[model samples]
Target: MNLSTLTDQIEQRYHTQAEYPWAKFPDYAVFRHQNNRKWFAILMVVEASKIGLLKEEKISVMNVKAKPDEIGSLRMMKGVYPAYHMNKEHWISLNLTEIEEGLLFELLDESFSLTIKKPPQQRLHKIPL
Candidate 1:
């Protein structure tokens, strides 16, 4: 899937809009959780060499948070690479032009779910009696 199609799918499924925070890179868009403001996905055009591609061409890619255990295997798959700007251990960069639509959506969903904040734990305190 391309950037536009992926972003549209994300907006429709996650009810979140893409935010362009960088003035210099207007094309860089971040899709974040509305409640906690945690970023789940970031769409940007980056140098292919940055992601280990032999050619230094600009390519559209999406960085998504991946489960730590799955990162190793995902990186082994085609079109998946170590995250360009995010933490590599828990995130991955996917080539939008190379990945299949179904797998792309599945990864996107996983990233979104990973960013969700868990409820804070309640603590019980004992009062002096």
Candidate 2:
């Protein structure tokens, strides 16, 4: 899916808007979780070489958090790549124009879920019973 559509869907489903925080790189948009304020996805234009593409042209890409166990297999998928600027084991970069919508949304949801704050578990205090 394209950047506009992806961002729109994210907004609609997650209730979070893309924020452009860098003055030097205004094209970079970050989607962050509201509660913990952790970033789940990033949309930006980068050199093809940055993403390990052989070509030299600029490409639109999105980086999303991935489960560590799945990162290896995810990298093997078409239009998916080792994260360009993020940790390879925990994040992945996608060729925005080339990825299928379903897979894109699937990964997006996973990322969002992964980065959310976890609630504390309740503990029962027991006396000698």
Judge candidate 2 against the unseen true structure and give its global Cα lDDT, from 0 to 1: 0.91
lDDT per residue, candidate 2, 1-129, as tens digits?
Answer: 566877798888999999999999998999998889999999999998999899889999999999999999998899899998899989999998678878988999999999999999789888996
Which ten residues in a row are the worst by lDDT in model 2? Answer: 1-10
Relative to the true structure, candidate 2 reaches a TM of 0.91
User: For residues 1-129, what per-residue lDDT tens digits would candidate 1 score against the true structure?
Assistant: 567877788899999999999999999999999999999999999999888899868999999999999999999888899999889999999998788778888999999999999998899898999
Please, what is the TM-score per model?
0.91, 0.91
- Candidate 1 off by > 4 Å: 122-129
| Among all candidates shown, the one with the greatest TM-score | 2
Cα RMSDs of all predictions?
A: 2.9, 1.7
